[model samples]
Target: MSSAALPTSALAISAAIRSGSLSATDVTRAALDLVSARDGEIGAFTTVTAERALNEAQAVDRLRAEGSKLGPLAGVPYGVKDLFDIKGLSTLAGSKINRTRPPADADAVLIQRMTAAGAILLGGLNMGEFAYDFTGENAHHGPSRNPLDTKRMSGGSSGGSAAAVAAGFLPLSLGSDTNGSIRVPSAFCGLYGLKPTYGRLPRTGTFPFCDSLDHLGPFARTVGDLALCYDVLQGWDGGDVACVDRPSEQASQELAKGATGLRTAVAGGYFRRGADPSAIAAVDRAAHALGASEEIDIPDVTRARAAAFLITNAEGSALHLDNLRHRAEDFDPDTRDRFLAGAMLPASWYIAAQRFRLQFEAAMRKVFSEFDILLAPSTPFSAPLLGQKTMMLGGSEVPLRPNIGIFTQPISFIGLPVAAVPVRVDGPMPYGVQVIARPWREDLCLRAAAVIEAAGVAHMTPSSL
Candidate 1:
């Protein structure tokens, strides 16, 4: 069967492969063909591992032929953000200098998990330089255009992950979110993306951005597919110090529960301010779909966002101080400047942000004690024009890069789980809403997202590209 004839979801593809209706080799070739034809326009993939993928797919087919039970992701092709280490490929975390690093001898922990579940790896995807920007524009690799509109932005760091899935080149892909990297891109590209609770998924073998805030998760067109990928990727890796040694919490099984008996609220006050009309409308629509009418104010949201910024800058900058000192000119100008500023920050400011972080987490815990889920805008607005530096927010023109994650920063600051579901508004580009749950409660977030998905208010629309 041709790629066009292949089923749209990963689970469906796996079932077809298991039943012998389709061969894993054929499915892998079909996906690679799509990437060959459309990826030039989207700039979604940095590399396409056709040879490696075909070999893996053939192995899956061999197992099925031998009467061995296949894994849940048996023949589904997927990609990961460039930060993830793939054996024999230098992990270019979207920078020019990383091209000189030696090839990785092993795969990232998450990659190992995906391989164990029988998923085929397509290749590495493009991202913002060193996971620093909100806009998807990358100087070394070029911008990863929005699948829905070539001229618009695709949101940052995880932009290629969202673009690849949204464009139908791949059914599932992985991305990292330090501060809204996955959510912002998913919202812009009109896909479902999950940012699991911090330390829930181990980060061994992946490039570091912010040690405390960094998280890796999946992107997909449907909520079930998203959860399926998440379930496969869950486990403890002793290699990663931040990883929590917890058993996998299967979210796919809990999806059918779908917002029943769950207490939900729409975030008000800080969440509503400075947001575009389309963003507010998207949140309202998602809230309505989940039967949430109560408005709740999350305390200290503004300060929480500020604290996140400080922590990210301090921690992220510390990782690249050597490069900033020696190869500053080789760095992306926007990323270099930000890292330089972060280096200048006093130790006291970093310490204070850490102190405030604990207090914020405690406050959020109390909020979660009262409500099961919270709904808010995933971004301030839809994707901005590609390479456009400034935008009007709150009736004043502001620098576009730092402000894109305003709503998302606060929630992630405290290591909460969030699901970003796309909602179509009056505009041509669709915005998204956040389904947030307390730490380690990704099941609740997915259940709420499933309810929104069931109502048809939040779903991925076909990309014109």
Candidate 2:
């Protein structure tokens, strides 16, 4: 493969390789070249494994020549967020505090699956410390710039994953969504990203911010690519307690039908409020594409967001309990006060949040009974300037981390599958709309998203980075 030819989607690269028009080795080289050229400016990666990628690419080429078998993801180059454990590499979780931790004993289950699928690891990318913050800014590793404009941001804790994909350095990346971590960055980057239903993908070996709420998913240039990665990574793992006995839905089945004949709705309430005008327009455009007519309010969202906050903070504070007690100075200042505050949270409040989860999820499930998919803005606005904090939305002031999750937390809180579609509607900031579906129905979300992408309603601008 020449440096000039890099496929941005699984559909393109897969077909090209199958037909011998493109070789995996060539694609790998091109991807590496992209990283070399643009990553210095974007800070999308915390590490890059050049030799590992080249070796994987060669193995793929051998398989291609033999015409024996090809995994669904053969030859795709991807960046794994630092939180995921990669064999022989220390998992940093984008924090300086974890820099001295020894290399992982084994790859995270999801990482092993991607490797088996013939995806090349381009090394770990940056993220919010301990995956606590919503903004992609890493006070420890420095900020990951938005691919669209170097001056702006890529939504965090999955910012690096989205930036790698959106900057065209890689076609795919792994991200975890504890609360809009994956979707926010994907939206800002104008790329397709999926946060699969909680437990749909095993999280063993992936650092956790919120045990009950964390989900592992993929960021990619297209819904199908996201599906391809999802299919490969999902299934039960005995090592992970959260891994459930759920049958994997066939990506070919849902994606084959595409977006035709799907019932869709535009979400209001939390989703409708506090977004840049362009973000709303993008939602409108997606609704129009899906032929959505009803504009329904998603009830219990405000409570859901509140509950998510309590749970995330509580669990997160516990995860770093020892560190907070003995080595608080080593923690990133960005999340230090927030975690300290959570440490003082009452036990009853945590319990109340759990109780609220059942009520909120029950209310959400009913809404799904009326609609196949729900659409809303991915963020209130595009990624703000690298160091900017506090965004005013719908005439209300909200902190950066919580505000980015405004339209997102309510949906993710209940473990629903969702796809963030990057919308290119005119705005001072670039943002995307999130399309959500009920648990285990990522098919519904991705199918609906494909429609808008096909119509060219969602597209990320090329980055100067």
TM-score of each: 0.99, 0.96
Candidate 1, run of 10 with poorest lDDT = 456-465
List all candidate RMSDs to the true structure.
1.0, 1.7
Check candidate 2 and list the clashing pairs: 1-26, 136-156
lDDT by residue for model 2 (1-465), tens: 445556667667767876778888888888888788878899999989889899998998899999868888888888899999988888999887788999999989898999898888889998989987777888878888887887888888898998888887887899999889998888778888888888888899988888999998998887778887888887899888987889988774587676677788998866776777778888999888888878998777888889999988898998888888888898887688889889899999999999999998888889989888998988888777777777888887766666778888887888998988887777545578888888888888888888887777777546323
**Which segments of model 2 are wrong by more than 4 Å?**
463-465
How close to the true structure is residue 269 of candidate 1, measured as C-alpha lDDT? 89
Question: Model 1, 1-465: lDDT tens per residue?
Answer: 566888889989998999999999999998998889889999999988889999999999999999998899999999999999999999999999899999999999999999989999999999999999788889999999998998999999898998898888899999999999999999999999999999999999999999999999999999999999999999999999999998898899999998888899999988888899889999999988989899988899989999999999999899999999899999999899999999999999999999999999898889889999999999999999998888888899999999999999998898899999999888689998999998899999999999999998885566324
Global local distance difference test of model 1: 0.92
